[model samples]
Target: MRGVRVLFCYLILAGSVSAQNIESLLMAGDRSAYNEIMSALQRKDFIEAIIGLNSFIPGYSSYGDLYFIRGVARMQLNDVEGARKDFILAKASGYKEENINFFISKEYLVGRLLKDLKMEIKLDSLREYRPVIESRDTIQGALRPERTCFDVYFYNLTVKILPESKSIQGSNTIFFRTTADTRIIQIDLFPRYTITSLKRDGKDLIYTRNYGGIFIDFGEIIPAGKMEEITIEYSGIPIVAPKPPWNGGFVWEQEKKRYNVGVACEHLGASSWWPNKDHLSDKPDSMIINLQVPYGYQGISNGNLRSQTDVGSGYNNFEWFVSYPINNYNVTIYMGDFVNFSEEFTNNSGKYRIDYYVLPKNLKKAREYYTQTKDVIGIFEKAFGEYPFRTDGVGLVEAPFEGMEHQGAIAIGGEYGKSNNRRDYWTKDYDYLVIHELAHEWWGNAVAIGDMADAWINEGFGTYSEFLFAEEKFGYPEYIRVAASNFSSILNIWPIVGERNINSNTFLGGDIYNKGAAMLNNLRCIINNDSLFKRIIKDFYLKNIYRIVTTDDFIRHVRDYTNTDYTGFFNKFLYETDPPVLSCSYSIDRKNNLTFNYRWTRVGPDFSMPFCIAVNNKEYIRLNGTSFPQTFSYENVNSFFLPNEYRYEKELVPPNSFTYYWTTWPF
Candidate 1:
């Protein structure tokens, strides 16, 4: 029955295999154009790559790899949205996951936007590169009893996007109950936006602004437990997302000369688009979004849409409501010419609609690619419990940027039409964007981070979810492949989990995503128990669902669940960039038996994790930092050689040849 359904969906959207063959077709449509672009890219001639790719794209726009190369070129050129768009198309086209991710990392790396992720790219020494365009001061809003005094119950936002003038006018109604007594309420909005009005209970209120904060006088010390609401009206031309998801802001793009609008305010704070208490720790229990755009375009936001109405002359209104708690940054609005397809996904959790919205021209591709949503969600639900936002269902928006784990409404820009559609290195027949963003419904969104500093708490778990997805689909070998691909992006210049009370604008390159995932993979290996690891993940989600949490909170959960002390493991990996190197040296005893000695260098004071040492491919011994003298008897083994089959992750692993093994990972 499932196969029958898949086949029917495939025919209507994906087309027959012969109809979409990727054979070498000359006459303007071929891999040579893309290869030429990649050749220039290989030589680091980003300019040449961009020019050739942009010129060649119109001819072979359906070729998936072309967009991947061009995205890399655009990142090098500092055209962030362009890079993101191309990467999305490449992902849709079925390009290799790591290939697409490698280029995406380049955008944040070269842009030098996020401080924690900046170090992954070593080319920062290059003089002619994109500088960090957006700088935010989030410490003041991060933690203060005054700002955190009230718990947000609901939010109502109405915004008018003027693309031609590049401006926005909006109002946000914040409904909250005071957790503590306070007279002044603190909310945030970028200074660029002008405050037109502030009101509570139909009475105007005075407010002062500083460092993106608006301090409003409630006029009275509202007692604790009292529920209150405030509405702020503001208008202005906001800062553009210099590089979205990193130096986030509004993204005003053009698709075939029409307006394609979206906002990625993750690092810049939601204040860039709408007024809010812009802190990760506080999330509104629910939200109502009404985005007004010029006619002929539909607006999309998180959660389900309640209405689409045309209010007289040349304008349309899209009102959406989110039924569960959401971070301010996850509150988004995308306006464009979109057509959608919907399918009901049924699993142990229940039956719900999985919708995909894309450009009218890409509807066929979206249809073909979206069928995988059911499979991906099925895997996730089995591992992480039933979908968190069943009321909201699951949605995929063809965003103008690469992608974001936007609560229930995930933005998938990889147009999959001309991309690599093969599971060549992939464990399952799934799209990386689809699987990744949905995984966030369990990790990044349902269970969120309290501070941007603890971003690894969201991203690391999200990255590991992808690893688990592969493992669930294709077993441990696939897990190794996925883990290895994730590790390739780990430059490890900074810690995965960040310090509190600071803005999350560091550029540790791919540390939070890739390195964090690697650490989790290593942790699973340390536990040497997949079932227990699975329980830890599922239980952690149930415990923190819809609540903002920290890395310490997660570490404690892991420790409590496993009944073991992993303080040093989490500390060494999450708080520091470098992993401990275990040096191996062996000696031949008088009886011709080999005695192996292992010692860790540059390790944390008490860092220890168990790893397996296989001697002569026969004796497998589990050893920690303190364990040594793992002897291999002569009768059992004459010489040593490294075992190649799946084992716990150790980045420094090498073949047992003395010179090769010793020369590989240095101290």
Candidate 2:
């Protein structure tokens, strides 16, 4: 019974099975049989469950749920062949393919029977559950002719946020230069908003709405290279975030009888709350944000605050100016009863200001915890060059949600780790939220991605920055521990890079953050040169600062810098769901020599990655492995005993300690 419980726990830990699903299956069948089988399972009695299942299944041969339970019981009892047969029978008896595939993909059956099943069963299950991509997705995601006809250079946005009604009234004056001679142009705003007026140079402009896209007709063809401006006046209730930073929208909440409000629209698009192009490819060169909130509440936004003025009504207008090219999503708003504090960050370049905004109650604790911001900024400057927006200065706004890299003004949440029960990853104490969102100041805000598909560039680098911070503050072992923890969360179900031009949220999964970081770490291992790796990262950031980038761009930069083509490496790691598997075997020769053979599996035919292996857990030797088997011989080693059969066929090479891959041995 203890062994059975251990096996069940192992399966849960491996992420191969869900206990809830097992419970659901147990409760689904005939009432009397369910009672018997569930009681046995509750007691961790696999033998008793198997005895009951055998009798019940024979009586109800078509019961697929019973067969699945019997398979699970057999698996726990270490009857691999019996479990395999039961699983196949269960599938043939019309059990859910997803459940069957998940069970069969476990480590126990992976090396033995997985090859016999149609691999598409798993893929088909995924396809069955994929959300239908609508026309709105295509319009928002694709670069249509209307969107490409003009290039936005600036945006002057003024909004009056009404917390009482949970609505906003605003106008965005768009300044653009024509790229092509066309009278029609497209901008995006959620259809929920009512457009009171659309004008260009004081003349009314006609527009039509479809999905979230607004197509405007200028009534005359603006010549190529012409400069133009348009102002859109609109008002509506914005979507409230179901889950912030992940699902983007306005967050309206109250703390201590005061409004604690802000907005985050990353994947959901800035258009969720305001009118804009609503695509990653377009970034305004400079902008002004004028936000009007209720009296006594401070309104904060990206970049530097230009002024705060009482508007004579019940609102105060706080205006901000962003002096550099900015992603639309990075433009945000925070309004609350806030007090301010400032610090100066001095580096090789010069002294830059760092501002903090918090509720008046949490001011003292914020000051103490936020001192680490300077250290984080300095460390990142050394790694990724001078802070990209030093001219704008740095600002941290206490937010209602976890955190977000909202350009110069980052959103930070949590109680500064004082009362929060989350564990610390580094030897020295620091806020993961602060460190992660700050890292995005360099990765996501400074060096931006042109498409959501390459969002790993933003999140992966941000996560890896935690590794860098750990290594710089503590040591390599501590960094390894952090990296291993990140690797453990990787799902590997979807590729880090998703289908392009579809507004896909595939990168929203943990893979983009965890697996993406592990991939970068693995690349460093493959390069085997810390200085060169750091140089590559710094160079990439320096070259692409304030510019949108793609995964191919970084791959090209790595190739150019390293003097080696890493296309296959990126293809395997970024484009594929699973890492390469290094299948290994060995034989003892009569001359007391051991001959080892190795090859790559579960990868492209051209996939070749270098990895290190330690013989007898001693000194490490690096070897380059490809699809074709390679051999190496070591002399004067005694013959070792071999198990009669390989139990669990594969073990994941600890990603923290080595390159990302898997290893399998047959004896």
Candidate 3:
């Protein structure tokens, strides 16, 4: 958690050169903002620490680990209820009690674990670093399967916005069915938002609170396969998003003489604003969202906009309906000065409009930047499938934070074409945000993963889509150059897959984006056939459309479809922190026949991957190896030129390493 507040502060301070290394920040000067809170925590000044933390967390609230640090500060101040609330927020933010146990226990104070956490803090400055290292705490937060035999179906929600007071009033009708005899149900809403009334079939129901979970008693058993509904009304100032998407909550901000607002819960969990099942596995097939906001402003939601009608007293109700299934975390609402314009694209599947919603002032910039959306949609449609929510259409809304892939309606902070940081590798003019966020329509929206642990399924593919777009728009060479540039951001500190049921971005560090994409790009080389690789990519997305899958589910598909054994291949890459390595040597036999020997090292014992090498900078050959050494023959072969993917020590050359992978041999 200390990594979070301090991380963002240093990110602004450190430029491209320092982006890859977190420890470099320590060598820089004037880190008072980060130290301010640390000193407050060390002095047991909870109020001062809270005040300092307030400034550090905006725009990154989904970062739950930081909230845990605040929880510790709360505990020291004897604010038991506050600490309890922060702990629940932490769990939702992905810092489940189990994951933090070995190094930092849930019950332990900041002072106790400061020694081990220092390195964790220093490394997490870049989104690329997080701890996938497992703890020995036999307890595993909520990774286990659900005990309740009930499944959520739909959420009919009513939200009344009161941004002036920084609070909201809401009612949610939860439609669910029981799979087994049961009298109890669990739903979550942040504790700060008090439950005003609870009813089932118009009858008041008795319920009890357990942190963020609100357990209701049905009084009589609801038989297996029974369908019922519960309507709960709650009102309070929801946790104001200190930061969004990352440290998410309800966001309230002022722009253009009125409040510009949006909700970004992502890892923070939807319960931060509205009440629901609050888990990834149970996405509702459809939803009805009704929003009432001040008359001068408008509210936007997921899926299709159904209606906007006057509701008296300078307020209007906007009803939105989503017929397709949606992740609860993707549920959102943005209200403010927004104007809409749309362009239609006719694809083989159907015709859908590409929609844009931005502030009046940003309309010029948005128009100029968003012209790339149509081409981007084409690239993904060619690669994966069609747009995910065509009827709802593709959406872009101006938000206070940078941006988020919010299902159909994406959020664009202020950076239209600018903040899309591709570094010097991308030789194009398109903004990174639009391309990256729209790609989610395929990876995250259309084909979804159940557990946050497999989030690479979303972030990784979404990221690689940029390279593919470059290849499609520019050429294959440009794609390679940009894709190669991706390696500079890679931090192999943690595995891409996190613990089951946890948000992969939470504690696993941030490689889910860069590392995940790099692995996929490298996999293209390993498959050794561009046609087959493209087919695999397209097939994986098409088959898993509107589905929830895991890393194993994907790897198995790749292996079974290709008629190759990738069980160990994927296990090492997905579960291990280090990437596969190759150790090599060459000798010229007396007969003038050159023999090359290579072994796969720093990988699973059964690891085997393909490699391409050019001899005398002339002919190229593909080589494969497991843990054992393998040899290749080419007569009169001189020096070798390896592709950028290889990692080997130079037994006979200076520099001892290629200009490729940052990590050296003995990896």
Q: Which ten residues in a row have the lowest lDDT in candidate 2?
A: 1-10
In order, how many clashes per candidate?
28, 0, 19
Please report, in order, the local distance difference test score of every candidate based on alpha carbons. 0.68, 0.76, 0.68
Query: Across residues 211-317, which tens digit of lDDT does each residue of candidate 2 receive?
Result: 99999998899988999999999999999887666666899989667899989877778999889988888899999999999998899998888999999789999
Q: Cα miss at 370, model 3 (Å)?
A: 0.9
Q: What would the per-residue lDDT of candidate 3 be over residues 599-634, giving only the tens digit for each residue? A: 776666766666555555445555666679788888
* lDDT, residue 617, model 1: 45
Residue 137 in candidate 3 has what lDDT? Answer: 12
lDDT for position 305 in model 2: 87
Q: After superposition on all CA atoms, what RMSD does each candidate show versus the true structure? A: 13.3, 9.0, 14.2
Evaluation by TM-score, superior candidate among 1 and 3: 1
Q: Which candidate model has the greater TM-score, 2 or 3?
A: 2
Weakest 10 consecutive residues of candidate 1 by summed lDDT: 1-10
